[model samples]
Target chain A: MKIFNYFGNYFSNRETFQEIIVIPVFATLLAIFLGLLLLIVSGSSNEIALKALIALFYGSFGSISSISETLTAATPLIFAALGIAVGFKAGLFNIGAEGQIILGGMAAVIIGFSFQLPFFIHLILILLVGALFGALYAFISGWLKATTGAHEVITTIMLNLIAYRLLDFFLRIPSIQKEGRNDPISKSILDTAELPRILYFLDPNLRVHMGFLIAIFAVLIVYWLIFYTTIGYEFRAVGKNLEASRYSGISPSMTIILAMSIAGLLAGLAGASQIAGVLGRATPGFSAGIGFDAIAVALLGRAHPIGVLFAGILFGALIAGGRQMQVSADVSLDLITVIQALIIIFIAAPVLIRKLFPWIFR
Target chain B: MYFKKFLKISSGAFAGVLLMTINSANAFTACQVTDVGGVDDKSFNQTAWKGVQDAVAKHGIDSKLLESKSETDYEPHLNSMVNAGCDVIIAVGFLMGEATKNAAEANKDSKFTIIDFAYDPTVPNILGQVFATDQAAFLAGYVSAGVSKTGIVGTFGGINIPPVTGFMDGFAWGVKHYNKVKGKNVQVLGWDPDAKEGLFTNNFDSTDDGKAFAQNLYDEGADIVMPVAGPVGLGSASLADELGSDKLKIIGVDGDWTQTDPARKSVYLTSVLKKMDVTVLSVIESVKSGSYSGGVTVGTLENGGVGIAPYHDLSSEVSSELASEVEALRKGIISGSIVMNK
Candidate 1:
């Protein structure tokens, strides 16, 4: 506690507001600049690429509807990235966000079908079930890491593969599949069970759901947990130096398991949001690469809760603008992924960008 | 700093060069392809794009292509194209059926054709061009039995939807008919024509899912496995390519597998062919010549719309007697002597 306040005071006068936001914001510009270079090298028009980039930004956040869409996308990303971010901060990389999400989503699917609760109750039930599922999934990896000294990276990746197969097999079980369609996807959640759109009173065309608000609340909770709580201090302590933390009377084994479980819960919520809020049912690979993207989001956000929220929104904007990119400038949408990859690269080596954009940091 | 500015200027100039394309007609405005996978998918999207290019060649229509990043894209991309003054729109996939349907109704004058989804005209401007992938798949299934070292055969799809289920049905039925004709037993698994719904991936995005299914089939001792999903079909081909075992082969779909896999062409026995390019080209031709139809354009083997692919490297491997048997099977299917089911 003393360390936080004393350290906080030491850095209190470090930079202007523009310096802090400007560096990351300008890092994005540098990334886009590099992305344009790639597009030119790939034999595409710079005019078209510029138009697409502009269109992506405008289509995602320029209009009220577009902003809503970005929030819709960002909502799930915030949960997933925050989940991964916690693990990242703890120095335990969780690569099974996809599987954890799939498992969590499947749990939500089962709950969504079996229950006949009130709207809020149903939503809470599904989220809790999804979170529990993700926590359990992460726990296994944690267990393996805690007991067998298996690397979290390798174990989590393998667990992701296992989760993929398990989800596929589990979706085939008759009780889970949509009736008649007997398809891999579960039956759609009931309309009442669905996460209600806050903007329905305004316009149905926009997809700004209650989940986005929930995601914001989740970010605050995570921030508070990490910064204010006693357990959070133990987690960070262990993450910094396991030997030192163990000597400081923190149970390394328990922290490892608990941290992973919490991480899993977030990932689970990510999937549950998609099911109850976005897609309304569990479809195979429906989580797509959101889990992996969360890693990138965490890296770009510098593993901070507040940064994750903004980074998630930016990533969400990219997704929301994907169609506009194709429509306006005739540029391929895959460039978004490339640009995302570049963000990670640039953020990892911010010194390079810092050198290039001295005015940004200044 | 001067050198850096000069570098940026040179890049901008180079970017300008890439924007250049030859324009032969003032009226030939460009159109873009929202290929769900990519242009090189060698499946429905690629076949339809071929037709688009053919139409472009015949009528001097200007166009380009853009692949879809994810499923959420269907509506926004279609709407964008419509807003951009694209006269005719072609979206490939059953999932995009809804998008094209919505876009067609919204943009009534804008002509749209969608592959894999056959439906009655909701909006007169929209043409749902669906293929009987089952008809072609059945032809391949029957041929598989003639060449199989093992009695077990396999087939899978992107989803249990009508188009995919139809292919599974025909393939399973074809194998059954082949057994009946040869007075032998053949067992097939994975896709059941009689089932209420089929086992499927639901979306055609992943090669890994298809790979798992194909590996399962091969492990279970199936001599041949056919995958109906676009890029997903390449999954089965990959397994076949990995092994030199003639006992395990892939029956390709859309275009010919033999043409696609020249390296492991010997192990790729045959394909259930859907001539999407032919169907799409005809639609474009009809529309261009002012004879466009509003309803479903069903492609059946009976109409030469779908058929069995030619055995390439496996041509010599297939006995002359077996080749003749495949020909007879195709004829029997077309003549209604063999009925592949709903």
Candidate 2:
């Protein structure tokens, strides 16, 4: 009681705290409560359901290895969600992040396995190429939206389907496919192009890599670009009211195109990070629906870079803990997905959350 | 605030629940990690898990499985199984080869049996289960050749991979063998062993593609069609049902689809069996008996690991003479008197 009051008093000092902080916090709690109820109603004993909940939390942040797992899982999410946030701030719904990611990953893997350049130079080149590829892919959608008034949602969805086939076509090429394997697996990237694990000194098992730091760097850059820069100011202005911003001497088309391109660049880095850091090679569907999940992350974060960072970690925790829950508690992994969907639903309707917990508003 | 009061009460309740002990571990736990097709894909994953269930019912060995939703889940799921201290972890499908190999090396104490893959050097702690599905598929081809009213049988694959092709190759060769034996000019469609080119849907999940391919083969005068695609073959089976067994008969694959998809049993001439469940159960039982060792186990007709299923509802349609000849061919191949392919 005292702890809640103390935190409430501390948070109530800021006007934006209710919408940004309290609402999300309450939404998460409400979702978890409902998830537990779901488990119990679905025929799990009370003890088993409680055990599953504890396993979920413990698997997320219980120890150093668990923390590393959470961070490792969070890396790509943070990168992609930050990109989605940038697009949202410009009033464009860029659903093409998945295609952008696929292109970026494909580009990175080609560069990763093909050349033998110096370590840092090779990695930087691969990342830049990946970012460039993603930016180019997204630029098409932005350009279409700016010039022809085609809906980004439709264009991006179609592009995603094309990207999957494109990956398949590329992977089938004799030069790109792994030697002696007829399967759709690509050649493994060179060691020099690999993203070295950051916690190798602490424990070789800890999979948290340099990508975590880069994701944080991306967060800082996106934060500054969103909150401090003039381009960002224009982006928010266009997002707030596009017709009014155009009348006020801002170029709506330019802002929309630039915002989407930036978004794509960040997402491309995510694909690059996964290839270089975690997977080491591109397989068909290797983006693993991270781009789709990032939409939820961005929405949950209210399309703020800082909020996306935390939301990414929270989602990462859910994934890592979901595995643990499955292993220890013998619960189906689908339960975690249900919980994630519940969280997204609650966050999407913050009014419902605020109404449910009206005393938090007071 | 009421919110704070609720939080306090919940926290207190959670603290109390956290102290409760988890259930004790079971003895001789065998676990499986499924491929992206999942455990219930009516394919290898499902067949492999069936072996574990059979072992549980027979030997009382506890069974568990973690389904891989994507490729990324492979390594993590393997690691989770290792962490859970599973005695034998069965990795289903060839896609899990690298992850299984890495995990086998990392955890030498844990025994692993991977379906559809074998290590080149033979890892000490892993038993690779590779089926001579071609052997069973050869018999299926003979049956198809025998049963086809049009003197032409067709076979196709999901992809140009060896697992799929092995079945197609054997089927084609069996038709050729049947041609030589009966002095009949029975033609094989959709596959040529010499050139190694054939019809492929390039997908294992799309029933639409399956239906189209079957229709094309049937239109080409192939009365019996063998589809080596996993769930995609169900589309052909449904088409066969609509067309009637007299007009179009289907050959099933992986498990005996007559049993797996019993609702459509009447349309099957005979299924090419891979026997993943039989092999998986034997591996688990060997582990239980302390006789488990790491090596590639090739499932062939001689070992009863792979064979053709009984001609269930269509038994009356197949002549006893044809059935006797198939038995002879199976023996002749096992005895090295008959060659399946060039």
Using TM-score, give the best candidate's number. Answer: 2
Q: How do the predictions measure up, each by TM-score?
A: 0.83, 0.92
- Give the DockQ of candidate 2: 0.43
DockQ, in order, for the candidates? 0.29, 0.43
lDDT minimum window of 10 residues, candidate 2 chain B? B17-26
How many clashes show up in model 1? 5
Instruction: Give the lDDT of residue B181 in candidate 2.
Output: 83
Task: Report the C-alpha lDDT of model 1 over A1-362, residue by residue, as the tens digit.
Answer: 64354334321223344433555577677777777777777877545555566667766876787788789888878998998878865668889888888888888888888778888888888889999999999999998999998999898899888888787777778887777554466777776668888998876646678889899999999988887888878777777778998998999899898889999999999998888887777666667778898888876666678878999998998887765666555666778777887887777665666678777555
Once superposed on the true structure, which residue ranges of model 1 sit more than 4 Å away at CA? A1-23, A143-150, A359-362, B1-37, B62-66, B72-89, B96-112, B118-126, B148-161, B186-225, B238-250, B258-269, B282-295, B312-314, B317-332, B335-337
Worst 10 residues of 1 chain A by lDDT: A6-15
Interface CA RMSD, all predictions: 6.3, 3.9
lDDT of each: 0.75, 0.85
lDDT string, candidate 2, B115-215, tens digits? 98889999999999998988888888888888888999998887677888889999999998888888998898998877778888766677888888999
